[model samples]
Target: MISADTTPPLTAVDKGRVTLLYHFVRLQMPAVKVSEPTFLTHLDRTFRIFIPKAPGPVSWAAYLEGLYAVDWLVCVGCLTGQNGAWEVLFNARTGRSDCLLVDALRARAVRLYPRDEERQDTAVTEFWGNLIAPDSAGTLPVLARYDGQRPLAPWLIRVFQNWHLSKLRQSGGTTALPDDEIALPMDTPRADGADRWHETFIAAAREWLGSLTDDERLLLGLRWRYRLSQREAAKLFDLNEGTLTRRTDKLRDRALEHIGGKLVAEGWAGDDLEGFVLTELGSLLTDDPRLSADHLGRLLAARGKSLPAG
Candidate 1:
C-alpha cells in the first residue's frame, strides 16, 4: 500500500484495516476522540516519517504493527523521551537511558570544573537540561534529530560532541573539533590478536547486555541472536513490523556502537573494530553461551514469559 509506484494514499484494504485497528485501539483508549479522517491524516504523516521508502510491506498486518506502537505512545503522552525515545527503550544500567546520554555528553561541555563536586554536578544538570530543552521554535533540541540510520550510540556520540563543540565555539571557549577530530586509530597486527579481541568484545558485550531491561535484552537477543525477522519481532512485542523496524534499528545500532567503542578505547585499530563487528558479531550473538537463543529462552521461561506462538 506504501510502494513508490502506488500514488493513492492507502489501498481500500489498508483503509479498512486501519478503521478496524482504530476501533480496537479506541476500545481500550476511550478518552481519545480523534476522528477517522484525522487519524488517517496522522498515520499518513507517520508513514512518511518512519517508513520513508521501503518496498511496501509483504503483509498488511506486519506493516500496521509499527503504527499501533507509535499511536499508543502518542495517546499515552509518553512517546517523547524527556531524554526522548531513549529513556523509554533503553535501560542503561549505569542509570536511566536519557541520563546516560547526558552524562556521556556532559564530559564534552568544554567548560569543565574538575575539582568541585557540587560544580560538577551542576554542570551535568545544566548540560542535560540544555540537551533536551526546546528551542525558540518549540521543537525538541539535539536528541530529537536521531534518524535511525547510523549506529545509535556512535551517531549520538558524534551528534552530541559536535553540538557541544558548536556551543563552546559560540561561547568563545576552546575550539571544539568535529567528528573527524575523533579519528579512528590505526590497527596493529598480532598472532593472538583475534583471540584477545574476541575475549574483550564478549566481556564488554555481556556488561552492556546486563545494563538493559529484561525486555530490551530479550528484544535484542531475539532480533540479533535468534535472527527473528521484523514480522516475528512485531508478534513477540505486539507492535507493528514497521515500528519494530524503526525501534530495532536504533536498538541494534546503539548496542553495536557500545561494543565497538569499548574495543577502540582499548586500542584495537578502527579497522579491526569495524571488521570484527561486521564479520564476527553475528556468530557471537548466535553462538555465545551468554547471548545464545536457548540461554535467553530459559531465562525468559524462568520469568514465566513465553515466546509468541508461531
Candidate 2:
C-alpha cells in the first residue's frame, strides 16, 4: 500500500507567504478588470488544487502563491495593452520558465501532428500524444508553474520548436528499423514438448504486455526502448523523478507477479520461478532486440528445457 506523508498541514509561514502574494496581485493587477472577489475566488481555487499536489522539498504552497501573483501580473499586462510584459514578469519571477516553456511546446506539437494509428513504430508518437492530451494529469504541474509570462499558446509553440530540433538530432540522419528486425527473440525447441513450452511462455508474455494500459506501455517504452534515465523520462512526462521511479518499480513488480501466477498455473513452482522469470522471460520480453536467439536458447537450457527439432 502507498504510504502517505505525515507532514502537518500548511503552516503560519505558508499562510503569510500566500497573504503577501495576494496583496501583491491586488496591487499589481489594479487594471485587470476582475473584481477583487472574483480574483480572490480564482486564487483560492488555484491554491486548493495545487497546494497539495505541488512537487516538493521547498514549500509548494508558497511556490504556488508566487505563481498566482505572477499570473495576475501577466493578466494585467495583457489586459492593459502592454505587449510582451507577461513574458518579462514570468522570466524574472521564475528563472526556469524556459524549460517549462519548451516542454509545453513539444506537448502541443504532438497533438497537432498525430501519427498514423496503424504504424507499428508508434512509441515516440504515442509518448507525445499522451503528454499533451486533456486527460493527462502531468500537465497540472506545468500549469502551476505558468506565470502568465507570454501568452500560454505562444510559449507552447516555442517549446515545440525546441522539441523538433532535439528530435532531428536524435534521428542522426538514419531511417527507422523495420518491424521484423525489431521482433522479440523466439526460442526454437528441439523437441515438440519444448516447443509447446516456448509458445506458451511467448503467449503469456504477449498477453501480459497487452494487459497494460497505453500509459503503462508508454512509460515502459520510454524507460526501456528509448533507454531514458529516470530523470530524463520524468521531465518528459512532467512527473517528479522520485514519483516516476516508484511508479516504474511498481509496474515491474506487478508484471512479475502476474507472470509468476501464469507460470504457477502452468505447473511451475518454488523459489526458482522468480529467477527463471527474471532471467528467461524478462530478457525476452524487453523492447530491445539485441538479445540473440542463441543466447535465449542457452538461458532456456539452463532452466532444464531442451529444444524441439525444427
lDDT of each: 0.53, 0.48
Candidate 1 lDDT, 156-246, residue by residue in tens: 4455545544665678855433222221111223465677887788778766766777667677777775568889877877789898888
Task: Quote the lDDT for 3 in model 2.
Answer: 17
On TM-score, the leading prediction is 1
How would you encode candidate 2's per-residue C-alpha lDDT over 224-257 as one tens digit per residue?
Answer: 5446689976776678999999989988888778
Candidate 1 TM-score, true structure as reference: 0.35
Stretches of candidate 2 exceeding 4 Å from the true structure? 1-194, 282-310
Per-model TM-score versus the true fold: 0.35, 0.31
The superposed Cα distance between candidate 1 and the true structure at residue 281, in angstroms, equals 5.8
Our tally of clashes for model 2 stands at 11
Candidate 1, pairs of clashing residues: 65-240, 66-240, 66-243, 81-84
* Best prediction by lDDT: 1
